[model samples]
Target chain A: MCDSCGCNITPGNRHLVAEGEPGHQAIDVLQHLLSANDHAAAHNREHFDRHGVLAYNLMSSPGAGKTALLEATLQALAGEFRIAVIEGDLETENDAERIRRHGVPAIQISTGSACHLDAHMVHHALHDLDLDAIDLLFIENVGNLVCPASFDLGQHRNLTLLSVPEGDDKPAKYPVMFRAADAVVFTKTDLLPVFDDFSIERATRYLRELASAAPVLNASVRSAQGLAAWLDWLRDDMRALRARIAGGEAVRPAVQPDGAALHAAESAA
Target chain B: MHELSVCQALVEQVVRVAREHGAGSVARVTIGVGALSGTEPALLRQAYPIACAGTPAEGSTLEINERPIRVRCALCGAETDARANRLLCGACGDWHTQLLSGDELLLEQVELAKLAEAI
Candidate 1:
């Protein structure tokens, strides 16, 4: 065990020896390695608080229509909210540009070889956008369901999207993502009939089992099916968020999005 | 897949800790990699060297302690180890279970090299 010291000490013995040595010592950290990223995320959350921005981290597999849903939601809620986006991808500013076309400011963070977007990257991207002017900030996370679940970007909520084409077993297959989700959106609902094997009831059941309190909403941008519910969720969430800020709460409460958006939609009509 | 970035973060923490303690170099870094941490130990081991290159942690030994996934079943009130990702209750065969452990990705300790003593 001791190739360097050549002493009759095991690796564990070396640890003890190192700790007892004059200058050499074994530091017992017992800390999460991602604490640095978590710290950065905390700072980002503080910034969002001062700006009254209700941030959402959108996570899903590739081609799950995250960008398309964002586009549709932006159009539907045009003048109601000041929305901005931070699009993350391994390559390309294409998603960011698409968001910009909807008249919302967006910043694309291209994480060269990184599969997930860390808090450090979001911290930099926050500086690039005018946070104070944004009512809502959408962090479209790397279009990835796995690695993104582990990294906290300090968003007010985490929403995991599962499209009908991706199958109903996604919640079970990728439990971490579902468990980490504040809410799960079933996107591309219009394609449900086409994909006979994809069951909304089954998906919702799994989502309920994993993320007990998280809402499982269905939306199809193509048919504008659940877009209203999606947009209302945003508006009502922002309203409650504004209320919290007005009341001097630094952080959002554990209040789930319980159809407040739907109530707002009804009142507007 | 993101083990490279995870290792990068690990290196940053190690370097910071090393500097704080006024250590010259890192001898060994011990960490816990849980079964459900979504990181591959092999990938992390491979990336550790690359992440450490050009830093004080260069050539430092990265010792990973694999932690098993532990779950607490609600039905049978039993705590059991969950092999793979089944997450079912071992005692009652129920899926109504909550995770108690195995998502941890922690840096347990760091062995710092001492400065050379005067003859």
Candidate 2:
């Protein structure tokens, strides 16, 4: 106890020796550290909804065929629905350039050293495109399986790709990323015949271990085996989103529950 | 790896709070770090000082409360604590589980310094 005003002394605030005597005030902030990003994400989501755009956040390790899959998806859907892409990388417009070649609007977010694309970056890119002109929007996050999964980015669905060469154990090793996925895709599946080490069954088992019931689809831009399923899935989501919007409601993806509370859509609603 | 940026945001919030309360300096800040939050606590701890440099919270202490993962079973409607990697419900071994409260990067409280009391 202090000789003067008896301020409660505890191990946590012991270092505040000067203030331990009295006049110490503790404020309950009760705020999420990711609140800013989440608010931006919610705003971005609203933009997508207002324009009736279906957004997807695509994440994976480097060279995991995100751009390649986007190229293939664009080729498949460009004729039916107007598409746009926001490509994220440490530093490069290469992915955006590739998407633009498909005659679709593509905005590039160069994060410099950031490992993931946050909502603010996506919001900035969102302004560059005519949201009404877009039917489907893909945000290709920086090639990272770890951090990208943690951010919302206002996507209606989160897709994490695990290529065949990357091995089936990826779902086991990165449980958080796989767990956050609305759907996990096995990219570069054409090489499965060559690589004996990769097994779709084992990968599915590992994903199930995380208690994730996310659909795991196979895809190969080169061979186009699962290409139809991918397109069909997009169409299904578009139809679902339309239904939700018609009922005066919006759709939210399965956000990692803890961080979900911080998003503006829920908080303000 | 994003811990540094996380810490930076944390410090910014703390400093903002201190300024808002007209505090001369900040004494301590507490945060909850969850297992599934995708942020490494050790890395966050190491990055705190760097983030707080030259701010009102310069010499403040950061208390990290490591939270455990908990999941709610869709089948059984039970909420149970589980490991980070394995999120199955403890009540029943069901594959359908909804995470209740594991991934939390939350700023809980901030202690601000005031005038010393007269002894």
User: On residues A15-72, what C-alpha lDDT tens digit does candidate 2 reach at each position?
Assistant: 4553343677888887888777777887888889888898988999999999999999
Task: Tell me each candidate's TM-score.
Answer: 0.84, 0.91
Query: Per-candidate DockQ versus the true complex?
Result: 0.44, 0.58
lDDT of 2 by residue, B28-119 (tens): 89898888888899999999999999998999889887887888899999999888777787888887888777788999888887544211
lDDT of 1 by residue, A173-267 (tens): 88767777877899999998899999989887766555245777889999999888887776776787778778876543232111222222333
Q: List the residue pairs that clash in candidate 1.
A: none
TM-score, candidate 1, chain B alone:
0.93
lDDT digits (tens) for residues B1-119 of candidate 1: 78888899899989999999888788889888776667778989999999999999998889887877787888789998875346776787677777777777888889888464211
Lowest lDDT 10-mer window, candidate 1 chain A?
A255-264
Enumerate residue pairs that collide in model 2.
none
For the predicted complex of model 2, DockQ is 0.58
| Candidates in order: C-alpha RMSD to true structure | 7.4, 3.6
Q: Fill in the DockQ of model 1.
A: 0.44
Residue runs of model 1 more than 4 Å from their true location after superposition? A1-24, A208-212, A239-269, B73-77, B83-97, B115-119
